[model samples]
Target: MEEHGTTQPGDGTTLVPGPGSAFRRTLLRRMLPAVAAAGLGITGIAGVAHGAAGGPQRTAAADFPTWGTRWVVHADADTRSPAVGMVNASAPGKDRITADYQVDTGRRVCEGSSCSSYMAHLTGPVSGFLTVVAVAIPQDRLPGIPVQGAPPPQPGVSRQEMLARAATWLTADNGAQVSYSQAKVWKDGYRQDCSGYVSMALRLPTPGTNTVGLATDRGLTRPVPLGELKGGDLLIDATGDNNRHVVIFEKWNDAAHSSYTAFEQRGGHGTDHRSLTYGLPGGDAEFTPYRPVAFSD
Candidate 1:
């Protein structure tokens, strides 16, 4: 049980939607709402790039034998800009590309034996021509494509190991706490938020589960009383919104239990090991304690 309560300063970060940027508008109007319904919200943007392959509908991978790639023609030819649009291999003419869509670059047009189609997102709007590439899917491999929002399989972990994992970001990258950003991921591929941090500590699948998943997913965690919170447990404010926050419980401050020590990755503070009153009487009442169901110890 670790109980020190001093904060180590970490860089603060923010995302300013670019004015008149088509990508920003498209992301806000199209991708966000879809991803939100998928239980990922805005933070899921980073994970989508890594080939979490589900879409509104599932098509048999066998139906498509070739994946399409296109070069973005824009004002800045030297600086390649990703063109964002819905890819309809079946569509004719300009009917295919419209609005903004986040493309999952991680899921290639062809994987060993399986194949999947992908969409690409432009960081900004650029007017130019497109050069399309048709890559044939290798026939030797079997079809095994992952759907979007699907988490990869992982094994259980011990409490000591979990805490140790949590401690790494405190001084990760030579004494720099992993910078916090919903739009970004740490070096390990986990989002840099409180819930993401806890997910990393618990050794969950990459990009990590969102706050709602951590609190409600029976396979990940279960409700536990504040009095019972032990090392590696969690205090999550699962509001199912952008304001949600979570912390890894280190230990209680005293027998009275007015506060406790925790590891949290917060906006403006990054990863921190400090005292928190989240579930206490006068603190934010939204926080509820939970225990990871995957704990091996």
Candidate 2:
């Protein structure tokens, strides 16, 4: 097994101390699925797996090869982060993140089902150790590439006419860092892409979500009507195979559903407001929006 460093989770128990501890080895044995699969997210703290009252917790097996999963692990990880190259979950919620599994991995492919392998990265922290946040997303839909073309409805600072809290991803780094330790990715004012915008706006555990994960993640969300969309809603463009995109719903620009202003991470630009029409108006780029009850604004 590859060893680098160790981490002491909230439970005071050492995972990979000095060399390789029994717990670390055992933990690796359990996290095999994560290593074997190329696109599976952290496999921890992301799935609402078979839970018991303080019982064991588990992550779902890698299934969507064409698609993938996304998640984060909020531990003090540094350059020498020793992941046991296996699949295992020790603590009950060891692998669970607040965003469930809807995240992005910043893989830039040609869209649809490509043959490139997608792996999550651990970005350096501005202050502390690298506690990473990652996800699985399509390559073509990474960031920078607008929904259809350039200027993907990138809007400016929100007016905040009526919102519980202002949308904070308006000035992210335009998905520069594919994935990072993502400490304080939300209101901390980090540069972000479209998925990164969603990650922070929704306060997810990680900053990675592509058009694919946005449309099919089955964590704690249910589909809602576009007309019924309120704050904190998501509108994903699941049109073509590789040209999918997503946006955070602010409010309808008009009552006729003609246009609406929302927040997203654009490619040419960083985070900004986007005035959308193609997906909403319906035609080739018909979009489907979903509302997260737990994360409703």
Among the numbered candidates, top TM-score falls to 1
Candidate 2's clash total is 37
lDDT of each residue in 1-297, candidate 2, tens digit only: 323233333423222222333444344333432332233333322322322334222233222211112122222332233442321123222232112111122322111222121222222111112121122222311121111111212112232321223243332236442222221122232224455456445533332344556667765356887678866677777664655666777777776878877766556555556677645656335678886545534
Question: TM-score of predicted model 1?
Answer: 0.52
lDDT string, candidate 1, 1-297, tens digits? 011111122411111111223343333333332232233233323233223435422322211112222223322211133333222223222222211232233322322222223332222222321111111212111112222454553523677888899999999956888778775445464667777788788866555778888888888889987888999888889984447888899889899999899888989979899999997899888889998887743
In angstroms, how far off is 236's CA in candidate 2? 0.6
| Backbone clashes under 3 angstroms, per model | 6, 37
Alpha carbon lDDT of each predicted model: 0.52, 0.38
Which 10-residue span in candidate 1 carries the lowest summed lDDT? 11-20
User: Could you say which candidate leads in lDDT?
Assistant: 1
Cα lDDT of candidate 2 equals: 0.38
